[model samples]
Target: MARKSGKMRSFNVAVVGLSGTEKDKGQAGVGKSCLCNRFMAALADDYSIDHISVLSQTDFSGRVVNNDHFLYWGEVTKTSEDGIEFLFQVIEQTEFIDDATFQPFKGSKMEPYAKRCSATKITSAEKLMYICKNQLGIEREYEQKLLPDGKISIDGFLCVFDVSSVPSRTIEKQVEAVLTILNNLIKTKKPIVLVTTKNDDANETYVKEAEKLVGRKEYKGAIMLVETSAHENINVDVAFIVLAQLIDRSRGRARVLPFIEAARVR
Candidate 1:
């Protein structure tokens, strides 16, 4: 359930990806961190595409090369024409471990590999819910009163793929990873958005191939497909806003304006 405070509604979205390793040559990293950083930076200041620093290929590949996860909070105070405001708290996770064996990844600058494989594991829907309730502090009041009440913890998911790496089998594996977690782990309907990152270097052939894959029956559950470029700030904000709107719609709430219109009005 959404935690509401006055006109603002808070949502927890999981930004999932398969971070590329050194083996994938010529393919920039999945760009999940870059996208999250760009969005959060926009939230903190004016939404300028050029203000944020760009991560070089070496830095992008080296940073977040492991299975570490991060949490980012952003608010879209821009009231829609319908007067709806949204607060989006996103968790950027590259792996999905089982709920029973989930442990938070603890890595530091001095010891980047400390407890890496042991701590960083994949997460299931149940595990994500557990993190939302216990770690992210989304619904403290509700949890205190109704501790065991059944409710979907995560509002939506942003399954990210590297558009530049779409030709590789890694894209298929990434898609399968998400489907495996969603279909086998916890059987609940949650909104999913297919996000292809690094669109600035997007290959038309690769992009078309990814679109074809998303059109398959297995990926029919994804409500939207956003092509984004975190380095160029292309559709970064729109991706989150669209997912937020879809989450609201999934819960049978009044629909908000499209991200373009809402952004313009703001």
Candidate 2:
């Protein structure tokens, strides 16, 4: 009898976080968009993956038109040493709340939050657009079904928080939102990566506290923490790669380990 080959593993990763506002400058979000852009830019050069499709919600003016969400797609057809093939799709999301009513967007209303727009291919020189929101929306009834009860559509989540914004009430609220997601997924045992962004400007005390928070007994050592700096091109790729490995491990597939080691060497 001939040996049988397994199917390729595909994973959908949601980048969730709250947007920060600078009352003085009127800016939104902490650094979720930047981090996504950085990872996509380095995917080809650093990880040796091929770009499938890249899309965004922002218009020419660099503003998120129709208050929509953004989505970016990519894939790893071959590992560093031509190992098993893997496909990865990453989406950018924020807490969907109506600006005027200050209420969560639900049902048909959620459709516009991540409405697909013209696809854009990002280059190393081009900067990815950013949308500021208190938090990224992860659940949608009608959307691509990123996550739903049982049978787990979404494979993993990258919960990003700005280390520089720690101690602030807004960031604290963001952490609470993340905890809620973790609690919901506890039963599913889904892999999650707690990414601390803006590490280049992170406060040592805040970073230490963040580490301790993830180490709490409630988490049971399930979450992987990675400190990243999207601005300086820091551990952005490492965070995603780790999440991929975790997703593989959760499914009893350890084939991604070789690529991980290859990524570290380069």
Candidate 3:
């Protein structure tokens, strides 16, 4: 699960959460920003879990596969000497034009995982190459929007909610965001994970309600429902990792592997 060497890559992770002042009902203090830390290579300010970058994936048939690394996306809301509040984005991978418009992004964690699940009929290296090519295409799609002339191409989204918020209010907003992303940014259905933070405030009722809501909507891609706590490091890694795995599967690849990094000398 080491970072691919040679160059530093980044990605755009849609970290959509409530941000507000004390005047607002569902304020921003929720661990929304903190979850961004865990998703980006285990970057907890008070605590840490490095495994967020790599997910132990599997195929539908069921098989343990290689660890896939994913990028966390967001803008820097808070900054400190130790690190920063938002997920890191590589410049070249972004559509940053000038100081006024600094674009941030997260890298695709697919090529590695795809390299591991290649069908028996296809060579691993070949599969990896295919994944790389697709990723490049996705990046290109966003490249236009990266320019000022185009709009942002948000392929996926992560709706973060706090357990302390009004259950109905938070869940409602989350569902709305998912449907909007489905109809707008993405060309096809994409994976969406429901992330409820603050494990200490675990509400069984809220969890059940959230599940029912998702069941009713029925997203085309895989769905992961989990409660995580950046405060206690509870299932933090699993949440993000599962999202990455599901996204890789969305590409219609029943299996995976690589030709770029896993190419054989033969």
Candidate 4:
């Protein structure tokens, strides 16, 4: 349900994680695309060759707003106006259009990243999915560019992992990395949601594994675990809805401005 109002806030949401982590890796057929489509409120059933390397944009009319589009990176980033332009220019200069080996689950999701690392393709040193700066512009720009990534601040994270795969150190690493950035680099306590994909594959054994995996840690806000299957359309909307709320909550949050405090002393 969309909020009925003339006013709305534009926020950027991104999907991120390391490769070979989706639904048993090398087994699932592009869960990222399916999840992205669902999260962005779109539907697609086929794989695309062009999706490899270059980022994809989709418009999502969120409950509070329209034109609430999301930018996806097989990895992710956050940037300012200046940083975003650099991202777009880099993409233009080094289009990821080449052959490469991707060891993860085979499909469109892995292709863009694979293409990015191709021998001939110039790759970005940092892993970031850029949300265009003009998105936060006054009115807007006809053309939008990606941000440089590394130093920009992110609002939230949606990490997708398979329920059937347990003892997933990879998933742990992914969570730690995002939390590390939010806590240390970005210095904001961003929200994180762990999405358990391929719910249909869950059995008694798998469910126990999933529970144990979730039990192992403490998270900010809440331990958000959403099970989804784009194939079955199970919890797909719920997962993203939770993500939206997290982003909203993040925006409503306020942090102490130490820099301002220091400047005040001067």
lDDT tens string, model 2, 1-266? Answer: 11226555566676765532332112345566677767665443332222111223222112222233443333333232224444555656544333444443332234322221111221111222232221123212212322112111457777776677544345456556555545554545668787887777776666775677679799988887887877666667667767777877532233222222433644
Task: Give per-residue CA lDDT, model 1, range 37-106, as digits (tens).
Answer: 6766644343333211122333222212222233323333333435556676655644222233333223
Per-model TM-score versus the true fold: 0.55, 0.57, 0.44, 0.45
Model 2 vs. true fold: TM: 0.57
Tens digits of per-residue lDDT for model 3, 137-227: 2443331212112112333445555665553356556445444433332333545566666755656665665565456555543445666
Best by lDDT: 2
Ranking according to lDDT, highest score first: 2, 1, 4, 3
lDDT of candidates 1 onward, in order? 0.49, 0.50, 0.36, 0.38
Q: Identify the candidate with maximal TM-score.
A: 2
Ranking by TM-score: 2, 1, 4, 3
- Candidate 2 residue 222 Cα shift, in angstroms, is 0.9
Error of 2 at 256 (Å): 14
Clash number by candidate, in order: 4, 12, 20, 9
In candidate 1, which residue pairs get closer than 3 Å at backbone N, Cα or C atoms, i.e. clash?
96-122, 96-123, 97-122, 97-123
Give the least accurate 10-residue stretch of model 4, judged by summed lDDT. Answer: 85-94
Worst 10 residues of 3 by lDDT: 90-99
Model 1 stretches astray by more than 4 angstroms: 1-7, 24-27, 43-68, 72-83, 95-152, 165-186, 250-266
